[model samples]
Target: MPRPLWAGAISFGLVTIPVKIVSATEDHDVHFHRVHLADMGRVRTRKVCELDGEVVPQDESGKGYEIAKDQTVPVTDEELEKMPLPTAKAIEIAAFVDADTIDAVRISDSHYLAADGQVAAKPYTLLRKALERSSKVAVAKFAWHGRERLGLLRIREGAIVLHSMKWPDEVRDPQGLAPKVVEVGEEEIEQGLQLADRMTIENLSGFRAEYREVLEDIIAAKADGKPLPSPDEGGERKSGEVVDLMAALNASVKAAKESRGEDHGEEATVHEMRPAKRTGGRTAPAKKKTASSKTAAAKKTTARSTLAAKKRAGTKTAAKKRSAS
Candidate 1:
């Protein structure tokens, strides 16, 4: 097993359990290093003092808080270590609340809480079982690294997991960017819901990041001294003003059904009233056909007119020849 990142005791009322925290997730993103174009040498950075033109060693450097425009107050590591915090070596449960009450956006990072030793295993199991039975999460506070953090403790997959939470102020206010209230018809709302239902999936395991895969392939090709692949030009999409909302929703539902190998016998009837089209300033009126569709209809009409003219000329020629005979 991998070594735990932190060792601490979890306390609640009169119960205490010695537990170790381990990271519950990992990053699989591809990383690159900066190199010189001429010699391919790895580029390195150094910390230098801004006030004095001198290279600062890692050991000599310490954290500081800027108090003024150009002045900062230096804080020593020893002083930070001596600061009083209840969670430095222990996680104290402050409250127990329904798990669903916590907003998913507030949850930040996750870690697994495991029993530190065999002596603590019983209490750890009891706490996990109790949390599972109550269907609630324990809100706890702890200090990790240099800052104190608020977290939630809950049972997951037969193990206790701790999730760090962001403060209420940390979440940005979305009101400024949110869309204004707009009227929507019942049929449009129903069709929109149907479209969403068609696209819903029970498991997200099948979804993979194709962009990352392509990036990795490009890197591999470069390493092997092979020719680079061209980037893909994705299909174009129509603007909201030109797009028939009901038609598009119906098409999406049909496509999704076809992708799942389900037989969609007949297309759903699109109601006349469409969902509001969002332009910059106001909702634009919906059109019967898009520009491309209008162009196609004009071409078809011209073709039919030309065909009718040719048929009339052929009949007139035949009549003239018969009269001459």
Candidate 2:
């Protein structure tokens, strides 16, 4: 079983529920060690004191705050633990707020608050059920690592979860980060919405770290003295420049639908609306002949043939008179 990181009580008005905090998430990243390139020797970093230039051990080191370039205030764990903060030994529930009102940007690390013992079971379950039924999260204040931090407590899978949050002042305003004002067509916006809908999923549980899987394969091949795996072909490379906005959105929606095994029987939400090409004063193609028009063309040909036959007969008559003379 994973060990508890901290043990504290939730001070909910008149009720106190003892709980233990454990990490709600774990990292599965592939770690690497520094090594010398010439002989592949492992290289390690050592902590050395600046003043004496001697290596320092982990247990001998302590936390210090630098007030100035050369002035630092050393603080010990005992002093921090014994500080007279109200939340030093308990998570003080300040108020309850609707869960939707909590800004995702302010939230950070999370921990699971488990009932510490049988004595804490009833109150812990009560708080969990209250949060679940009320559909609200508890805004709380707690001290960890020698400083007070804002927290949000809510129920997760029948257990209480404490999410560390930044204070309102700690979150920076995003006034300058946005782009300049520009107009977007309604069709483009609608197509973007369609794309979002096509890409939506119920949960993120289906995803995995494909990069780490490939990395592990590479390491295993190297360790076994075998040939390294070749890169997969036909991978789509993302491009920065978009020549046509509507065309890109249409393509994205189609691709997303195809990825999810959805049928594109109906046309996409928007088509690429392109301007009509200029003719440059060129004449257009003649229209196809209708039945009445074909009859009129045949009559004109017959009249021309009759006129040629009459001219030939008149020439023959003139030739006969000349011969007689």
Candidate 3:
């Protein structure tokens, strides 16, 4: 087990469980240190005062909120600490509700929670057992880093688990992103649902950590001084704009079945809007990749016909290529 980064006592109604919060997740994102442009040397940043041009002392600095362009509101650590303290420090138990009631978007990250020592073993096991037997999550609140966070504590695989949650207002309504969720035809939605059901993979073997793999490849390629991959229409090395939504979806379904080995035959989506004719009048097949290729083999794919989609495609291409080897 990794060393615990934080040690604290979980507090609730009357029970205090001594526990340690360990670094639960490890991020493998490829990162590069900042470097001087001309010399290509590492660039280190420090907290230097603009007026004195010297590193500032931690005790001399404080956090401030900007009220206006030049106005500010100052808060002291002592005053901030007096506001409120969450009763339960260790995994607190509140009321448990049906898991289906909570939307998945509300969850952020999950962490494994374990008792500190042999002393907490019995109670921890009992709590986990109760939660598992009832098949309900404890909707509890925890004060983390001065902010009170809504979290759900549950039992998974005989162990306690926690999922941090977002506030109700944090999630945006879907109505603003499109015309109207109600305006969508029932048949079209059903078709989409069916398509999704068919496309969902039941086996883990079918899934790939392509993003991680691609990033690693690119890093190796760059270290070896290999040429960067080109940005072609993401496929067939040809570029064209999509004109219709429903048509594109239909075309994709057909193309997938024809070339991508799509199984489970999906139901076709029916949309009111149709795609416009290809403006550039180009027909190009994506470049084929060989085993000796230094760049990513699969092309970036997107169905969104907006600028965001284009930017995302570019990002995916770059990241994929960088990690690809």
Number of the top lDDT candidate: 2
Whole-model alpha-carbon lDDT for candidate 1: 0.78
Per-residue lDDT of 211 in model 3 = 65
Q: Summarize candidate 3's per-residue lDDT along 99-154 as a digit string, tens digits.
A: 77988999987776768998878777777786788877778777666567787877
lDDT of 1 by residue, 126-165 (tens): 8898899999999999888888889999998999999999
Question: Cα miss at 112, model 3 (Å)?
Answer: 1.6
Q: List TM-score per model, in order.
A: 0.77, 0.78, 0.66
Q: Which stretches of candidate 2 lie above 4 Å from their native place?
A: 235-239, 263-325
TM-score of 3: 0.66
Off by over 4 Å in 3: 9-16, 50-53, 65-84, 181-191, 203-206, 227-250, 255-325
| lDDT per residue (tens digit) for residues 77-186 in model 2 | 99998999989989999999999999999999999998999999999988998999999999999998879999999988988999999999999999989999999988
Better of 2 and 3 by lDDT: 2
lDDT of each: 0.78, 0.80, 0.62
Clashing pairs counted in every model:
0, 0, 21
